[model samples]
Target: MDLDLALVRAFTTTAGTLHFGRAAEELKTSQQALSKRIARLEELLAVRLFVREGGVRLTEAGERFLPAAHEALAAGGRAVAAVSGAGPAVRIDTWGHLYAPMRTVAQAAQALGPVRLEPGPGRDWPSVAQALLHGGTDLGFGRVHPLPGGRDAGLTQRLVRLEPVDAVVGPDHPLAGADALRPADLREYTLWCPAELTRLDFLRRFADAFGIARRQDGPNLGLDHLVQHLRGDAGCFTLFPADAPLPDHAGLRAVPLVEPVPLYAWSLAWRESARHPLLDTLLRGFTETGRAHRWLDYAPRRDWLPDTDHAKLAEGY
Candidate 1:
């Protein structure tokens, strides 16, 4: 028969207690069952392991085996500790549009050690701030918006770039023909928008200025879902980061939102108390990489969109 961990535990406990009754009590088993287990262990080893003299004692052979049994138990403990002692990994959360930044972080982690990238949670500034403040992440990246009173006082924020926001629509939509759309022009069609709570105050201000009221429509959040609806001719229009790649679908087109509020600044943020060396390395890498690529240039002619290349962002870092 194969060796059993339960039998090993029972034998160790019995050896330590030196009394079958006490060992059974500690193990929450009947004395008869505990005796049977010890007997089975002895039979498996083909040796006399214990003797009941006055109370209970290890036999000559059992005395020699006791240390080996303890060594086996210690080995099991070390195995468990080895698995658990690897330390917790760093977590960074970001919106889906910041795939380039995510790739950069991933490359940095690979060169360093284990790390986790959490994505698609923070759709606006408040959500991003809350994620950092609540220990949900070690760092966060997203477009900047008007900070709530007292929010900026406790955190460190860096404006990385000014990204333009554009209205994305399906090819067959009437406004798809326009080279550029003013906020007033958007009121003529139904605007597919994320829920107000998930949207930043600046985006809400832009919508209000453009006279586009929130519509009660199917699937009120999620860019991918909104794009799917647009593809089906659902009379839907949603805003996207100009630096984000246009969905490869033939049915979609992105037109500039010709208002002053159509532009947003991207920022990387962390709590003031966060002082990890890796965090500093990642920040430096991101800043240097962004500068080298001229990612801050938001000119219409610039083609700096997020892509799936880690080596490209890690070029100078």
Candidate 2:
């Protein structure tokens, strides 16, 4: 009798985790259904793969079968991906046209082969993250880097660059010449935070500190349009990271915010199980950038903030 690929995958996952419940959850299947698959697998092989007493443990035959199982599944996955055009082709998410300054680190991606860097269809961080979780993309660079718990299946977030929040206003605006700003100084102006970016954790946290709320003033709130409004009498202002690329308009200026506003950073995220060379290349670019001195000095690993690759961000991954 031929062994089933599903059974092999279930066996491998259960063996790797040594827990039926976790393996079932990882496989996105029910425990009962998984147990039955295991039973079928043992029946076909005529060898008991697991022994359950207090908890699951692999049998000698199971240990012997593990390598073959992994090889078979990996081969099958490669074949499927090749035919389906889903992998071996790196697809990473980009926000409009924003990506962190990698300090010549992006050049290393050439060693990994072709990359397809594209924007998420929804044009928001949430959509980008959701696409990565559901296998729509291999990696993502976004503003919102929430934790991997809840419905997300173990997505990984790596902070690449530390960027402070900057408020941009027209050259003629009253606050344009302030040189620096504080939370209290922003009370009078209605800040225009795009609906798409309000979900960023640091932005949301800092906005709450100043009682800033989400409001779109006009039809075009993109980086280009927002700057035009700053050059006009829009009676509004917008926030962006210090590292974000702005249009080459002479009348626009991005001012630094003084203490008390939680800072924001650029993050690269991907699935924990996604082990592509392209993903590793991007991770290395962010990790090996040698920018520990630039890390956020204050409570960087705060609980409320999303999972960050602090070790990598601070000490190279």
Report the C-alpha lDDT of model 2 over 1-317, residue by residue, as the tens digit. Answer: 77789999999899867899999999999999999999999999999999999899989998878756865665676678779887654556665343233322353344334553443433656666655654556677655444445544567676655556677787877888888887668777776654444444454555566677644443434556666666775457777766666777447778887754435555677777645455665565445442434443445442123234334345323
- Encode model 1's per-residue lDDT on 1-317: one tens digit a residue: 56776788788788767899999999999999999999899989999888887878888887777645654554554466459985334456676442244544443344444433445455556766765664445677765444658765556666555556788888788888888877677776776655543454445555665677754344344556666777776477877777666557546888886644355555677777643335666666666666665655544333322221112223322
TM-score, every prediction: 0.54, 0.58
What is residue 153's positional error in candidate 1, in angstroms?
4.4
**Candidate 1: which stretches are off by over 4 Å?**
1-89, 96-127, 146-153, 213-224, 232-235, 258-261, 298-317
* Model 1 TM: 0.54
User: Candidate 1: what lDDT?
Assistant: 0.63
lDDT of 1 at 232: 73
Clashes of 1: 0
Instruction: List ranges where model 2 is wrong by over 4 Å.
Output: 1-88, 96-122, 147-149, 196-202, 213-221, 260-262, 290-317
Q: What is the C-alpha RMSD of each candidate to the true structure, in Å?
A: 16.5, 10.9
